[model samples]
Target: MGGASNDSSSSTTRCGVFELSIFVAAIVSGTACSICSKTMMELHGVGIDGTMELFTKPIFQTFGMFVGMMFGLIMHWAVLVLKIPFPGYEHTSALDNDQRPGYNTTSTNYGAIQSEKDQLLASQASTASTSNATPVWMYFFLIIPSIFDLGATALCMMGLRYLDVSIYQLLRGSGIIFVALMKQHVLGDRLFFFQWLGVFWNVVSVILVGATAILNSNDDVDLDPNDAFWGVALVMAGAFVQALQFVFEEKVMSMEDAAAPPLLLIGMEGFWGTLLCLVVVYPLAYYFPGEDHGSYEDPFNTYEMFMNSNTIQWSFVIYFFTIFAYNLFAVLVTFMLNSIWHAILDNFRPITVWLTDLMIFYVITETGDFGEPWTKFSVVQLLGMFVLLYGTAIYNAPNAGSLKLEGQWYSFGFNLRGEYEEIELEIHEEELNREWEERQQNFKARRTSSLAERSPHTSIHTQALRGFASPKI
Candidate 1:
């Protein structure tokens, strides 16, 4: 009776207090996390002109993200459609004993899932292999995410036009905050207090970033017509859609073919994303393009819409290679961080995007073209970035212990323990029982009278008999 009543009260408290906040937060956070991939990729989309201010180029990074997409449309279109190249091989690697995994938590599947993610991330990070194949049907899965991606990309471009690259990047970094929020609400994830603190700090950093942009606006160049309205609107849209993808990707990561590998998925996504864009945008853009598509001379030109490069053009070739390389880069790095993480598709092409933009701007000036000088970054803005970095570190505290994994060669998930997954929630019955039995044995092994009396079956093993049990996210 006491247990039942307690359960009832707990349920009421949970329902009455946490639901709404979690949902709202998840929607916002998910969008931010999803853009991590997009942002990295964005660097490859738009090429920079020496005449433009690096910070001033609104969507330069975004233009870079889809470089391959642009190239595919212009260069690889015919070859891709016909399926001419067929390697017909699935590369396999022997796992070192170090690569073995274990399940050590209430969420029995967590360790395994993470292990798989690590493997996938490794493939994504390195560019040794090449493929000319794709699962064509994958295009169908893209509609939902692509709609959201395009919407978000549009918004990112708009925001850039009104703001500088540094400011826009800082703002975009807030997507992680949104991720935390989504985890709480949409995913019903419980957050540690420190994680919340990290989220708060990150938010403050974004505000600082915005302030920096506004302050830096003292000297300005010409604004394209309707750029602000459209850019801002698209940015907001991107944020919203990014949140959507964060949740969706997490939910899908554990499914059959999904958990199978990460690099393959990244490759397929780029391939299909490029294909879909080509199919939808090409005809409307090239042959019967909307007035918005602009002219042929503008292919690799604008950071806002499409590139000015073409199939046979040198700039066009460079653009595609850059995009592909960075997409691979971003996918690999972020995968190392978290599979639940997003693929923003921006920030992938360049190291210091704003810096590059500025260099380009100055070169354009040296050529006798008028280029603007950028004197920005207030003290407050600098501090804000520092705070943001701090917040990111704090928020990642749960996984901070794994920090050594960064940039380490042997650290490529060589050792796995307590593995689990996001979408594929079922735990094997034997596995669960084994865990329970192990816990009981551990308790007995400890032989602490007081601890043993507290209920020996309390570990995940107690839940073993329950079929299809999923680990907590």
Candidate 2:
């Protein structure tokens, strides 16, 4: 039983290591979803009237965000309150299963009931923790990052109107630099020499890409040098806010109890973020009407766009649904991985979006023969892409180990190498020693009882012989 138990645990850890690929796919899917929404806005003319409607509509854009948040809220309730499992995510701790007492996973019906009952207990415990009157300031602190995140996202939407999604991804790549600095200063994280080199490379690549976009506009798409400059600036500003949001999220998650439901926490952020955006959207609509190009035809047209046009209304439905699913997946990844790796994984966004655009153009849209900013297939852009890839590789390389890539899922402390095995072996040895000692003690007790049982019979036989000899005398 002990050996089987150890084997089960080891297998679970191995499965977790394998699950890394699934986690990456989820992140990529979420990123692609968001990129697709941005592209739709760019194509459909979300910023046409300088209003906020999606694809040149302002009211619909805000509605889409709200609708997405609603989806997030519903998912959180289902997972955290209703105790329903997320499809394809039924195994949250495939690698780090802690088999608690009363949790018998071997039986389907009874075990499921037990698991749900335990989950209810956990939920009640979390509620009790909240009822203990957590400091109001802590709640505010938790919420501040969500506001910054929303602000950054708004800027990103506006920037998307001017810059191609690929270039915008390149510009936002500088997020690694800010994240590194903040990790060092605010979180007391120490980077190794290679990690710092990676950071340096990231900075250089960002500069290369940004300069290429701004100075060399001939082969680039719709961007003049002037527009490119401002677009890059807005993206950088958004990246800055995004950096703060990442750091703040890390801090809040760290402070949360181990038993707390991460999705619930994320849902709270989305709920509040949507409310905050409501307060900011009107002023944003007035001031940012596409920065001189997409001025709104009428102030009330933001609302009128949905009521008047069926196509626009359907687009909102798609946009909101996509954004909702994206957030759910992204938030799960965020909770499982730290913000650092989260940002790192996001480097794939540009490549994914670029490929997606290529597919769309060649098959669906049938846009003009691919060239310039529209296709973003120019040699200079390709060079920038290579640089970005190189930087990301250098940055995520193992910290201080041998050249052999030692993969570790830090969230669960599971390692893919024999190092974890070595530790487990030591533990197995200790268990064996304990069992051996118990076996020896049990053997000695059995031997002593048998000897005692024979001694009484032997003494009686000796006494009978003595009596027979005395009677003959």
Candidate 3:
């Protein structure tokens, strides 16, 4: 018993360490993606006049992200076609059936039953390998979320043009508010009192962050107060749209027979997004009139400038890889750990981006070549960051009123619930046991009924003996 306990403890510690590593990787990659994207937009090029900041093509930026998503689809296809061993692909149906509670695998007929099950599974696998065509309805079903993603990303990119990367990250917390409201109305989920309080604090954080942007607009020569306000509005609107996407995606995933691999879903969305941008969004932007046609997202000019500028080219390349890496790591974190851990780590991403922005401004680029310096530090902005973090923690914390930290030492020394893992294990075991009991009762009833039909004059004791002797598979 003691040896078994020690082994379990060691295994849990290893899992915790692994999850923590993935969490850190997710944060770093996500921050890199954000910073690289901003750098691409702020990069300057030599023109007829002088050195001018030329890249402000939000639509093109969105298109590049969709192109990166195509790689995810390619990966999914490679995995399926190559028969790769990937996480979340484990087939446990036979194992689960064998391990059912009170089921005797040592029976005389157990070997035959197991062999037949294995043969059936192998036949199904062979059939699936020969015909792997995806259903057409899946493509149509995924387009809904893709449209939402396209709109959200385009709006955020447009907003990013006006605001600093740090502010943009912070303002994204507003999506929690929209998600909460939607969950209540659409999903009929009830929020605890603490969660509602967290929402209120999040609202305060958004207000504070927006006020800081407007107040410090005069410090930067290029930033206009009106533009900053519009940027805040645009980001908030993007957050709302993104929340809608999240809710809709959840609904789709929750439906019966609608489950798909995460990477496959992402790839499908990328396909639709790329198609829409090329045929719809780009054309509309090109024909539509704007106040600053050249400076704004003019795709024709963007293509010309992209061909000439190596800096812009390298920036986009880095952005593409970092964004893909971030998404991959984020998905891994969600699968390996839990959504709560993912949310907690995500709240820290804005802080990482902010510190990286400061380092770039003060240490890397002293001449302000990359972008405008974030030299002016506001106390209110710091307060807003803390408020946002606290609110997120409150919302994600398990239970109500108070927070309890419990987990393995390697799980960052804290989890939302004290007995979360143990409780989940116990509940799962109970469910399995109950299911097994029901199946046993049903099987006995069927055997008894068949015996009665076959031999009407058989005694109840003889029927019982016969049922036990010749157990049905």
Candidate 4:
């Protein structure tokens, strides 16, 4: 028993570590993908000048996103319909059957009857699930959030085209403030004083970062300052829209009888989102290419351009696969972990993005147009980054201040084993045994009296055999 307990504990610890690692990897992969997308834009000349039209647009990123969503939809259905388990999980039916009420079986063929009843119950549940599922029309509501999600993605991609990876990541981090505020207002969740303070610090850091950008605009960063500000604006807009999308998703999930598993919900959103993007954005990307300037000329025929430029074509393929993988990782993380954990992981992303970008740019080859290194950040910007980090730490920290302390090492949250006393409920064994014996004696006496009063034809020994009375008595 002790060995079994230890093994179980070890298994639980291993699973926890595995999940944490997966979440961290998801964040890193997402940051890496974003950097890759920006590199593609730099290589392809999509974000160079605001007014220039290009014959070839950066619509490949948009198409890649659509394909990723479609992939997600297909994977989810494969798991659900095919009853295949997701990797790392055991194969089991997605529809829970254990909660169904058990049927009583009192005959000699109880096992057969129980088996038949279980099958009937399973069939009934599947039918009810199909019949009572969300109306097809209500799926249109899902399309709304998908549109917002796509808009956010497009905006972020645009921002990446103009901004450095570090600064762009920092700016996107400010979106947490929007999400927090929306959660408080829309979900009726109250923010603690520290959380509110974190919000204030977040806002201040954003302003400082923006100011730093303006001050350093004239430097030989190679990027136009005006375009940098435009990137900032686009990121902020994307963040706000993304926040709205989150709230909208929450509202939809919270609706009565609309409760669905996260996998299915995400799959549906991806399906609708892909359809909407293809219908609205696909044609616009191809036919109404942006106005042309020297490098910014719209490729009215993207297919022709893709086929002609080997570099662009290869970049598109990489972006396609990377974005698809990123989305899958994101959904899997969300499915396995709660949103708060996801948000906390996101808050930790700037550090990872900064470190990753620094290593990639400084250690690896520099492709001139991917913006400046981390060393180019202004002193004010560094301070602002620290302030933001501090605020986030405070916001996420446990409410340890409320814990009562007995000594330097002693608090309500934990106890020192040496000084702590074991708690055991008092049990009077002697009294309990006496009461139980008396109850038994009384019960036997009643049984004796009842047997004498029973029908003359009934056998007392037969009644005892069937547990109607104590046999020894």
TM-scores, all models, native as reference: 0.50, 0.66, 0.73, 0.68
Q: lDDT tens digits, residues 1-473, model 3? A: 01111111111111245556777898999899889988887876544333464687789888988888778788877866564544322222221222211111111111223345455644654454333334568778898878988998899998898888888888887887887676666555454445666677789999988988887786767779999999999989988887777656544432323334456667887889999999999988877777335334567577667777899889999988887777667655544433333444556788999888888887898786663355455678889998987787656544222243445462345454534344345435645664686477446434532212211232332222211111100
Please report, as a residue range, the 10-residue window in candidate 1 with the lowest summed lDDT: 1-10
Best by TM-score: 3
Q: How well does candidate 4 score on lDDT at residue 140?
A: 64
Off by over 4 Å in 3: 1-22, 46-53, 91-121, 124-134, 219-221, 291-296, 331-346, 371-377, 399-473
Ranking by lDDT: 3, 4, 2, 1
Query: Across residues 1-473, which tens digit of lDDT does each residue of candidate 2 receive?
Result: 11112121211111133235545665566556655556555433233354454444433354456547556556655753453544211221111122221111111121222344345544654454344323445545546766776777766666655666677877777787888777766655555445566677778778777776775555555557787777788888888888887666655544422212345445666667766656665556656555334543233545554555566566567767666665555544444445665566566567776666656666666563321234334456667777777677656543221121244442134234453345356446745764685466345433532212211222222222111111000
The TM-score between candidate 4 and the true structure equals 0.68
- State residue 410's C-alpha deviation in candidate 2, in Å: 26
For 337-408, candidate 4 gives per-residue lDDT tens digits of 323334444556667677766677777766643434654556777877887776665454342222222233
Local lDDT at 118 for model 3: 55
Q: At residue 283, what lDDT does model 1 achieve?
A: 39
Model 3 residue 304 CA deviation in Å: 1.1
Q: For candidate 1, what's the RMSD?
A: 15.8
Candidate 2's C-alpha lDDT? 0.52
Off by over 4 Å in 1: 1-139, 218-233, 256-260, 279-315, 333-336, 339-351, 354-377, 398-472
Tell me, by lDDT, which candidate is best. Answer: 3
Q: Candidates' lDDT values, in order?
A: 0.40, 0.52, 0.63, 0.53
- Steric collisions counted per model: 82, 17, 0, 15
